[model samples]
Target: MTPHNELRLLPWSGPDGKPCYLSTDTTGGPLSRLADHAESAQLAASTELLEHAREVLVDETSDPEELRLLATDLTCALRDALRVAASRGHRLPETHASGHGGDAGPSLPAAAFG
Candidate 1:
């Protein structure tokens, strides 16, 4: 089993809105693959939303209602992007700071920004 610090942070939350984690020795498991696909889709959606936001920002005729809707979408996209980043960051392998074997330092929590 993977250590507590090494558990994978799933891309989606639970029914109660709490963060979810996966503990497995291999990354090729079904759950891991599902999380991978979900993360990829989320990142793509965020990228597309960014382009739309840029277009709206450049359009001087955009109304207050449109801007408000855009803000809501951007907020959702930002949340997903942050979750993906946190998940990937946690999975990153620890590295030595110098030639000598030593702890690189404490890692950021998987849900630090959640």
Candidate 2:
């Protein structure tokens, strides 16, 4: 993990204006390492879930309800990953009008996820 001083969590708005998370660490510390691990896990899980969803979507014999459930699960996992990334101060590029950028000041609240 990067040093606490080097970590910067940029906030992005969520459904309820919740902060989006990202992190940038030049020196990998324990915390940064942990965050990296968490990120990798989330990424892998997301990929797996998405692939499952796709397979379900393409499987003509698959139950529609199961496909829906898988999609929902994928969405939830993605949201959780985003939250975790935000909590770690990972940088997230602004994609919407209300996104944090430019003169919007700090992207995330200093107290976010603390």
Candidate 3:
């Protein structure tokens, strides 16, 4: 049986909107390599966009339109980072507040992807 960590699939897509998944156990497998590269790229973008956000936020002369665009970029960066996180591990179980059952089963390891 596949490990639960490997089974933790993150539903995301490629630049062209093609569906993709990430699994750490693949090791040298094609999908594993692809996901690693994609995650790195996403991290890079997020880092740069974060710097841009700081600049935009502090610049008193920044235009409202430019600020809006920067906000959109930041949101995209955040989404990518979140996808990477989800791909590498399991998600939180549904809580009673969400109308789901409270029995959340076993807890996954902190470094489940590793």
Candidate 4:
């Protein structure tokens, strides 16, 4: 059986917005392939949305309604991105050559995003 943390965090939710997991060892299965495709689409959409957001921010004539809608879209994209990050993070190997333990790298300070 797969370890709890090793279970794949599926791209979509289950009942009532709860997260779903897959325990199969095989990565090429149908569900896995679907999740992979969904993740790819989500990331691509986020990239496009970011570009549009930059344009909206730069345009002085953007109305309040437009800004509000952009904010909503950005929030959804950010949520998806965070979910993808968490899923990928859980799947990382226990050790790496970086010697910073199993972590990817040093995390940025919270103020960096401010």
- Give the Å error, residue 53, model 3: 0.8
Please give the TM-score that candidate 4 achieves against the real structure. Answer: 0.78
Task: List the candidates ranked by lDDT, beginning with the highest.
Answer: 1, 4, 3, 2
Off by over 4 Å in 2: 1-27, 84-114
lDDT of 3 by residue, 5-111 (tens): 44544435769886465545545667666666778888997898898788889999999999889988888888888877876555343344333665645668989
- Please provide, for model 2 over 18-90, each residue's C-alpha lDDT reduced to its tens digit, 9 standing for 90 to 100: 6534444453656556656766787788888877877888889998788778878987888867766665543
For model 4, how big is the CA root-mean-square deviation? 4.6
True-vs-predicted CA distance for residue 104, candidate 3, Å: 18
| Backbone clashes in model 3, listed as residue pairs | none
Compute the lDDT of residue 1 as modeled in candidate 2. 35
lDDT of 1 by residue, 44-81 (tens): 99999999999999999999999999999999899989
- Root-mean-square deviation of every model: 6.2, 11.4, 9.0, 4.6
After the best TM-score superposition of candidate 2, give how far the Cα of residue 14 lies from its true spot, in angstroms: 17
Cα misplacement distance, residue 80 of candidate 3 (Å): 0.6
Candidate 4 displacement at residue 47 in angstroms: 0.1
What's the CA error at residue 71 for candidate 2, in Å? 2.1
For each of the candidates, give the backbone clash count. 0, 14, 0, 0
Highest lDDT scorer: 1
Report the CA-based lDDT of candidate 1 relative to the real structure.
Answer: 0.90
Name the runs in model 4 displaced over 4 angstroms: 1-5, 96-114
- Assess candidate 3 and give its TM-score to the true structure: 0.62
